[model samples]
Target: MTRTRVPALGAEGWFTLDAETPALLGDRCTACGSYAFPPAGSFCRNPRCASTAFATVPLSRRGKVWSYTDAQYAPPSPYVAPQEGHVPFCIAAVELAEEGLVVLGQVVAGVTVDDLQVGTEVEVVLDTLFSDEDHDHLIWKWRPVAAGGAG
Candidate 1:
């Protein structure tokens, strides 16, 4: 199936992981060579650093699950949840070792609250959150990658 939703590519001419290629985009500090995922728009988020300089970088697709939880209830408004028949979903914080950062996102299709456990290794994927009468929103997701293989 093809998804029409187009997510926010990036803040300023940088590329984001979306359909066909799901990868986290980030920034690297020129001074200390530290990486920042989700691309710090204004300045470096590093506590010890005091520089605004950064360069675009792509994160590894594969990561280990740092933590996770299921949403038994629908998230509050402005969240864009389903209008009726609310269903529980899972969210996870994945740790990319190459970037040394944790990115939180939704789980991939066929993955449920029962199918997940802490510390499971997963790979990133692009998925659609929901499409209403007005818009279709694409978002990053993750699923268990096959052993020794990219998902």
Candidate 2:
């Protein structure tokens, strides 16, 4: 039996799960060039800019680690743990160079706080959040970029 895939969190247009390289979807102000994650619609997020037009944009997949920490406790609602219960996980805030924005996500399974450092290069990858009999929920995660290799 195969389990269907789903987004663990109900965010539409936030990221793509079907691309060769998974990328976070963002909205860029056509007028001010400001970018926002979760793809802002209907308005420019830049306060100084009065334009409401936006273009859907794929965010940079690679970034430098800005900060990181371990989540030892189960997260609050909207996050569901597996049947085994809460497992410690590392979360990282990565700074995208072009956008100059920091996006937070969990590090790939098996990654830990000790395995990361500020300025370490990382790349976005799709990962399973949890699985049920009917579906395997997916989410974006960060992984250390292999040395001298493209992400």
Which candidate has the highest TM-score of all? Answer: 2
Q: How far is candidate 2 from the true structure (C-alpha RMSD, Å)?
A: 2.5
Residue-wise lDDT of candidate 2 within 1-151, one digit each (tens)? 8888777757657888773588988999999999988777988878899998998998999999999999899988777886577889999999999997999999887788888999999999877888889988888888898633332
Task: Estimate TM-scores for all models.
Answer: 0.80, 0.89
Error of 2 at 86 (Å): 2.2
Residue 21, candidate 1: Cα error in Å is 2.5
Clashes of 2: 0
Model 2 misplacement above 4 A: 147-151
lDDT of each: 0.72, 0.85
Candidate 1 residue-wise lDDT, 1-151, digit = tens: 5535567333233336455666777889988778876677668777898888888877898888889887878888667664476677788899888788898888765567666677788887766566765546667778877532332
Clashes of each: 0, 0
